[model samples]
Target: MNNFSSPKIILLEGIVNESGSLHFFEYSEALPFSIKRSFWITEVPQGGKRGVHAHKKETQVLVALKGSVKVSLEGTSGSKHEFILDQPNKALILPAMFWSEVTFDKDTVLLVLSDQEFLESDYIRDKNEFDEY
Candidate 1:
Protein backbone atom coordinates (compact mmCIF):
# COMPACT_ATOMS: atom_id res chain seq x y z
CA MET A 1 0.00 0.00 0.00
CA ASN A 2 2.96 2.23 0.53
CA ASN A 3 3.41 2.39 -3.19
CA PHE A 4 -0.10 3.59 -3.93
CA SER A 5 -0.36 6.40 -6.43
CA SER A 6 -3.27 8.25 -7.97
CA PRO A 7 -4.12 6.79 -11.34
CA LYS A 8 -2.95 8.96 -14.21
CA ILE A 9 -5.47 11.35 -15.66
CA ILE A 10 -6.93 10.15 -18.94
CA LEU A 11 -7.68 12.84 -21.48
CA LEU A 12 -10.30 12.03 -24.05
CA GLU A 13 -10.12 14.18 -27.10
CA GLY A 14 -13.37 15.67 -28.31
CA ILE A 15 -14.43 16.60 -31.80
CA VAL A 16 -16.09 19.94 -32.18
CA ASN A 17 -18.45 20.89 -34.97
CA GLU A 18 -21.05 23.47 -35.80
CA SER A 19 -23.79 21.46 -34.19
CA GLY A 20 -22.02 20.22 -31.05
CA SER A 21 -19.04 18.35 -29.70
CA LEU A 22 -18.62 14.64 -29.19
CA HIS A 23 -16.59 12.82 -26.57
CA PHE A 24 -16.14 9.13 -25.96
CA PHE A 25 -14.16 6.71 -23.83
CA GLU A 26 -13.52 3.02 -24.26
CA TYR A 27 -13.06 0.68 -21.29
CA SER A 28 -10.40 -1.41 -22.96
CA GLU A 29 -8.00 1.47 -23.42
CA ALA A 30 -9.37 4.48 -21.57
CA LEU A 31 -10.38 2.84 -18.30
CA PRO A 32 -8.82 0.09 -16.28
CA PHE A 33 -12.14 -1.53 -15.48
CA SER A 34 -15.52 -1.93 -17.08
CA ILE A 35 -18.18 0.48 -15.94
CA LYS A 36 -21.00 -1.23 -14.11
CA ARG A 37 -22.82 1.89 -12.88
CA SER A 38 -22.86 5.61 -13.44
CA PHE A 39 -24.04 8.71 -11.60
CA TRP A 40 -23.75 12.44 -11.63
CA ILE A 41 -23.57 15.27 -9.13
CA THR A 42 -24.86 18.63 -10.25
CA GLU A 43 -26.06 22.07 -9.19
CA VAL A 44 -23.54 22.31 -6.37
CA PRO A 45 -23.48 25.61 -4.53
CA GLN A 46 -20.53 27.89 -4.89
CA GLY A 47 -18.72 26.50 -1.90
CA GLY A 48 -20.40 23.16 -1.47
CA LYS A 49 -18.49 19.90 -1.19
CA ARG A 50 -19.09 16.17 -1.21
CA GLY A 51 -17.43 12.77 -1.01
CA VAL A 52 -15.39 12.10 2.10
CA HIS A 53 -15.22 8.36 1.94
CA ALA A 54 -13.14 5.53 0.58
CA HIS A 55 -14.45 2.59 -1.40
CA LYS A 56 -13.81 -0.93 -0.20
CA LYS A 57 -13.99 -2.67 -3.55
CA GLU A 58 -15.00 -0.23 -6.27
CA THR A 59 -12.99 1.73 -8.78
CA GLN A 60 -14.24 4.96 -10.30
CA VAL A 61 -13.52 7.43 -13.06
CA LEU A 62 -14.82 10.97 -12.67
CA VAL A 63 -15.38 13.64 -15.27
CA ALA A 64 -16.69 17.17 -15.22
CA LEU A 65 -19.38 17.29 -17.81
CA LYS A 66 -20.30 20.96 -17.59
CA GLY A 67 -18.26 22.80 -15.00
CA SER A 68 -15.21 22.49 -12.77
CA VAL A 69 -14.53 20.34 -9.71
CA LYS A 70 -11.65 19.85 -7.38
CA VAL A 71 -10.81 16.36 -6.20
CA SER A 72 -8.60 15.41 -3.30
CA LEU A 73 -7.27 11.91 -2.86
CA GLU A 74 -5.71 10.24 0.16
CA GLY A 75 -3.99 6.90 -0.06
CA THR A 76 -3.38 4.28 2.59
CA SER A 77 0.30 5.07 2.29
CA GLY A 78 -0.41 8.59 3.56
CA SER A 79 0.12 10.02 0.11
CA LYS A 80 -2.14 12.83 -1.06
CA HIS A 81 -3.08 14.20 -4.48
CA GLU A 82 -5.33 16.93 -5.78
CA PHE A 83 -6.71 17.43 -9.26
CA ILE A 84 -8.87 19.95 -11.02
CA LEU A 85 -11.34 18.76 -13.59
CA ASP A 86 -12.16 21.87 -15.56
CA GLN A 87 -12.75 20.41 -18.97
CA PRO A 88 -15.17 17.79 -20.20
CA ASN A 89 -12.39 15.86 -21.88
CA LYS A 90 -10.31 15.37 -18.75
CA ALA A 91 -10.91 12.65 -16.16
CA LEU A 92 -9.60 11.30 -12.91
CA ILE A 93 -9.30 7.64 -12.02
CA LEU A 94 -9.76 6.52 -8.43
CA PRO A 95 -8.99 2.94 -7.57
CA ALA A 96 -10.42 1.01 -4.62
CA MET A 97 -9.36 2.05 -1.14
CA PHE A 98 -8.45 5.59 -2.10
CA TRP A 99 -10.07 8.16 0.14
CA SER A 100 -11.61 11.00 -1.86
CA GLU A 101 -13.22 14.36 -1.24
CA VAL A 102 -14.81 16.71 -3.74
CA THR A 103 -15.31 20.46 -3.75
CA PHE A 104 -17.47 21.75 -6.48
CA ASP A 105 -17.46 25.05 -8.25
CA LYS A 106 -20.79 26.79 -8.61
CA ASP A 107 -23.16 24.88 -10.85
CA THR A 108 -20.67 22.13 -11.44
CA VAL A 109 -21.77 18.99 -13.23
CA LEU A 110 -19.72 15.95 -12.32
CA LEU A 111 -20.14 12.49 -13.73
CA VAL A 112 -18.79 9.32 -12.16
CA LEU A 113 -18.66 5.76 -13.42
CA SER A 114 -18.12 2.86 -11.06
CA ASP A 115 -16.69 -0.54 -11.73
CA GLN A 116 -19.18 -2.10 -9.35
CA GLU A 117 -22.85 -1.71 -8.61
CA PHE A 118 -24.16 0.11 -5.57
CA LEU A 119 -23.20 -1.82 -2.43
CA GLU A 120 -23.46 -0.38 1.05
CA SER A 121 -20.81 -2.79 2.31
CA ASP A 122 -18.37 -1.43 -0.22
CA TYR A 123 -18.14 2.01 1.30
CA ILE A 124 -15.99 3.35 4.12
CA ARG A 125 -17.77 6.49 5.22
CA ASP A 126 -15.49 7.52 8.00
CA LYS A 127 -11.88 8.50 7.67
CA ASN A 128 -10.97 6.42 10.70
CA GLU A 129 -12.94 3.49 9.37
CA PHE A 130 -11.18 3.79 6.07
CA ASP A 131 -7.81 3.93 7.79
CA GLU A 132 -8.56 0.70 9.59
CA TYR A 133 -9.54 -1.11 6.41
Candidate 2:
Protein backbone atom coordinates (compact mmCIF):
# COMPACT_ATOMS: atom_id res chain seq x y z
CA MET A 1 0.00 0.00 0.00
CA ASN A 2 1.31 3.41 -0.97
CA ASN A 3 0.91 6.25 1.49
CA PHE A 4 -0.91 9.14 -0.14
CA SER A 5 1.48 12.08 -0.59
CA SER A 6 2.28 13.55 -3.96
CA PRO A 7 1.22 16.05 -6.59
CA LYS A 8 -0.85 13.23 -8.01
CA ILE A 9 -1.93 11.04 -5.13
CA ILE A 10 -3.76 12.49 -2.14
CA LEU A 11 -5.87 10.36 0.12
CA LEU A 12 -8.16 12.14 2.54
CA GLU A 13 -10.09 10.16 5.12
CA GLY A 14 -13.05 11.29 7.20
CA ILE A 15 -13.95 14.18 4.95
CA VAL A 16 -17.66 13.48 5.34
CA ASN A 17 -17.87 12.43 8.95
CA GLU A 18 -19.35 15.61 10.36
CA SER A 19 -22.75 15.19 8.73
CA GLY A 20 -23.46 12.00 10.67
CA SER A 21 -24.73 10.42 7.49
CA LEU A 22 -22.94 9.51 4.29
CA HIS A 23 -25.74 10.85 2.11
CA PHE A 24 -25.62 14.37 3.56
CA PHE A 25 -22.04 15.60 3.69
CA GLU A 26 -21.31 17.58 0.60
CA TYR A 27 -18.45 19.68 1.87
CA SER A 28 -16.22 19.82 4.89
CA GLU A 29 -13.93 22.32 6.63
CA ALA A 30 -11.14 19.77 7.04
CA LEU A 31 -10.34 19.78 3.36
CA PRO A 32 -7.14 21.59 2.47
CA PHE A 33 -8.36 22.74 -0.92
CA SER A 34 -11.41 24.88 -1.45
CA ILE A 35 -14.24 23.35 -3.40
CA LYS A 36 -14.98 25.01 -6.72
CA ARG A 37 -17.61 22.52 -7.85
CA SER A 38 -19.51 19.58 -6.44
CA PHE A 39 -21.04 16.61 -8.22
CA TRP A 40 -22.24 13.11 -7.53
CA ILE A 41 -23.02 9.85 -9.32
CA THR A 42 -26.00 7.84 -8.17
CA GLU A 43 -26.90 5.84 -11.23
CA VAL A 44 -23.78 3.73 -11.56
CA PRO A 45 -25.21 0.28 -11.89
CA GLN A 46 -23.01 -2.77 -11.69
CA GLY A 47 -20.42 -2.89 -14.49
CA GLY A 48 -21.08 0.74 -15.43
CA LYS A 49 -18.13 3.09 -15.64
CA ARG A 50 -17.15 6.74 -15.67
CA GLY A 51 -14.07 8.93 -15.99
CA VAL A 52 -11.50 7.74 -18.50
CA HIS A 53 -9.31 10.80 -18.84
CA ALA A 54 -6.98 13.26 -17.21
CA HIS A 55 -7.31 16.95 -16.44
CA LYS A 56 -4.75 19.61 -17.28
CA LYS A 57 -5.55 22.02 -14.45
CA GLU A 58 -8.40 20.57 -12.45
CA THR A 59 -7.74 18.60 -9.29
CA GLN A 60 -10.39 16.41 -7.76
CA VAL A 61 -11.15 14.51 -4.59
CA LEU A 62 -13.33 11.47 -5.23
CA VAL A 63 -15.35 9.95 -2.45
CA ALA A 64 -17.56 6.89 -2.47
CA LEU A 65 -20.51 7.89 -0.38
CA LYS A 66 -22.47 4.68 -0.85
CA GLY A 67 -21.71 1.20 -2.11
CA SER A 68 -18.29 0.60 -3.70
CA VAL A 69 -16.21 1.75 -6.62
CA LYS A 70 -12.78 1.14 -8.06
CA VAL A 71 -10.48 3.93 -9.16
CA SER A 72 -7.68 3.14 -11.56
CA LEU A 73 -4.90 5.70 -11.73
CA GLU A 74 -2.13 5.87 -14.29
CA GLY A 75 0.77 8.18 -13.67
CA THR A 76 3.11 10.09 -15.97
CA SER A 77 5.91 7.67 -15.17
CA GLY A 78 3.84 4.76 -16.42
CA SER A 79 3.02 3.66 -12.90
CA LYS A 80 -0.48 2.48 -12.23
CA HIS A 81 -2.54 1.93 -9.11
CA GLU A 82 -6.01 0.78 -8.25
CA PHE A 83 -7.90 1.87 -5.18
CA ILE A 84 -11.12 0.41 -3.89
CA LEU A 85 -13.29 3.02 -2.30
CA ASP A 86 -16.20 1.82 -0.21
CA GLN A 87 -16.41 4.21 2.69
CA PRO A 88 -18.05 7.62 2.62
CA ASN A 89 -15.54 9.39 4.83
CA LYS A 90 -12.53 8.61 2.68
CA ALA A 91 -11.40 10.31 -0.50
CA LEU A 92 -8.73 9.99 -3.17
CA ILE A 93 -7.33 13.24 -4.42
CA LEU A 94 -6.29 13.12 -8.05
CA PRO A 95 -4.12 15.81 -9.57
CA ALA A 96 -3.47 16.92 -13.13
CA MET A 97 -1.85 14.54 -15.65
CA PHE A 98 -3.01 11.41 -13.85
CA TRP A 99 -5.49 9.41 -15.82
CA SER A 100 -8.30 7.88 -13.80
CA GLU A 101 -11.27 5.62 -14.40
CA VAL A 102 -14.10 4.75 -12.07
CA THR A 103 -16.12 1.54 -12.14
CA PHE A 104 -19.01 1.10 -9.80
CA ASP A 105 -20.62 -1.89 -8.15
CA LYS A 106 -24.38 -1.76 -7.80
CA ASP A 107 -25.89 1.51 -6.59
CA THR A 108 -22.79 3.48 -5.93
CA VAL A 109 -22.66 7.16 -5.13
CA LEU A 110 -19.42 8.75 -6.18
CA LEU A 111 -19.02 12.32 -5.05
CA VAL A 112 -16.40 14.59 -6.47
CA LEU A 113 -15.02 17.95 -5.42
CA SER A 114 -13.16 19.87 -8.06
CA ASP A 115 -10.57 22.63 -7.87
CA GLN A 116 -11.13 24.28 -11.22
CA GLU A 117 -14.05 25.27 -13.37
CA PHE A 118 -15.08 23.12 -16.27
CA LEU A 119 -12.98 23.54 -19.40
CA GLU A 120 -13.09 21.28 -22.41
CA SER A 121 -9.54 22.11 -23.43
CA ASP A 122 -8.20 20.99 -20.08
CA TYR A 123 -9.33 17.46 -20.51
CA ILE A 124 -7.08 14.78 -22.07
CA ARG A 125 -9.27 12.08 -23.48
CA ASP A 126 -6.62 10.04 -25.22
CA LYS A 127 -4.29 7.86 -23.23
CA ASN A 128 -1.50 8.19 -25.80
CA GLU A 129 -1.82 11.97 -25.76
CA PHE A 130 -1.79 12.00 -21.99
CA ASP A 131 1.28 9.77 -21.89
CA GLU A 132 3.17 12.20 -24.08
CA TYR A 133 2.61 15.06 -21.67
Candidate 2's residue-wise lDDT over 8-120, tens digit each?
33344433456664343344453456677889989877988899998877788888878989899888888888888887766777777788889999989888878777889
Residue 46 Cα positional deviation in candidate 2, in Å, after optimal superposition: 0.5
lDDT of 1: 0.84
Any residue pairs clashing in model 1, and if so which? none
Clash count in backbone of candidate 2: 0
After TM-score superposition, what is the CA distance of residue 113 in candidate 1 from its true location, in Å? 0.5
User: Can you give the TM-score per candidate against the true fold?
Assistant: 0.90, 0.79
Pick by lDDT: which candidate is best? 1
Give the poorly placed runs of model 1, Cα more than 4 Å off: 1-5
Q: Tens-digit lDDT track for model 1 on 1-133?
A: 1122465588987798999989988855556566789999988898788888998778888999988988999898888889999999998888888899999998889999888899999889989987875
Count of clashing residue pairs in every prediction: 0, 0
